[model samples]
Target: MTLSRALAIAGFVVAGLALLAVEWAARRPDSRVPTLGAVVALVMRYDVGGLPVGRLAILLFWFWLGWHFLAR
Candidate 1:
C-alpha cells in the first residue's frame, strides 16, 4: 500500500480508538484515564453554534486526506 493510504488508515484507526476511549471515560467518570476524560470534556464544552467543531474538523480532515491520496 502507498504511504498515503497507510496514513489515512492509521488516522482512522486512531480516531476510532479515541472515540471509544472517550465513551469508556464517560461511562466511568472515576476511571483513571485522565487524557481521554479531558478529551471528552473538551468536545462536550466546545461547539460552533450547536455543531461540534472538533468532530467536524476531524471528519473534514479525513475527507480531505482521503481525497488527496485517492484522486491521483
Candidate 2:
C-alpha cells in the first residue's frame, strides 16, 4: 500500500479508538471524563458582551463542516 493510504487507515484507527474510549468513559457512573453533552453545555455557557459567542462558534464550525463535506 502507498504511504498515504496507510497513513489514512492509521488515522481512522486512531479516531475509532478515541471514540470507543469516550463511549466507555461516558458509560461509567462515577467517571471523571465528562460526556459530550456536558462538554457542549460548558461551551454554551460562555458569553461575550451578552452575546452567546460559544454557540455562535459551534454553529460556524458545523456550517463549515457541512459546507466542505456535505455540500453537493
Candidate 3:
C-alpha cells in the first residue's frame, strides 16, 4: 500500500488507542485519555486536507464512548 494510506491507518489506530486510554483513564484523576481522544477527533476533523481526516473521524466514532453526546 501507499505510504499515505499506511500513515492514515496508523494515525487512526493511534487516535483510537488514545481514545480508549482516555476513557479508561477517566476512571481516575489522570483522566486524560478520553479527553485526548476527543481532542484527536477534533484535530482530525479540522480539515487537514488530503490526509484522511475523514477516515480518522469515522474510526474515532467506532469506540462509541459518547464523548460528545450531551453537548447537543
Candidate 4:
C-alpha cells in the first residue's frame, strides 16, 4: 500500500487503542481522562481521513455519528 494508506490504517489502529484505553480509564470513578481521550480518538478518526468525500465521506459519516453521541 501507499504511504498515505498505511498512515490512515495506522491512525485507525491507534484510535482504536486509544478508545479502549479511555474505556479502561472510564471504569475508574472521578476520571475525566477517559472522556478526553475518547474525544481525541474521535477527532483523529475524523482528521486522519482528512475530509468527507467519496469513501472517506461514508467513513466520516459513521465517525461523526459516534462522535456526536460519545463525545457528549
Q: Pick the candidate with the highest lDDT.
A: 2
Clashing pairs in 1: none
What does candidate 4's lDDT look like per residue over 12-60, in tens digits? Answer: 8999998788788887888766575566556556544456344466567
| Candidate 3 pairs with clashing backbones | 22-33, 22-34, 23-34
Full-model lDDT for every candidate: 0.78, 0.90, 0.70, 0.73
Give TM-scores for every candidate, taking all chains together and pairing residue i with residue i.
0.42, 0.72, 0.40, 0.43
Model 3: per-residue lDDT, tens digit, 37-72? 566667667656568776677677864646654445
lDDT of 1 at 14: 100
Question: 13-32 in candidate 2: lDDT tens per residue?
Answer: 99989988997889798888
Candidate 4 residue spans exceeding 4 A from truth: 29-72
> By lDDT, is 2 or 4 better?
2
Q: Given candidate 3, what's the lDDT at residue 35?
A: 58
Poorly placed runs, candidate 1 (over 4 Å): 29-72
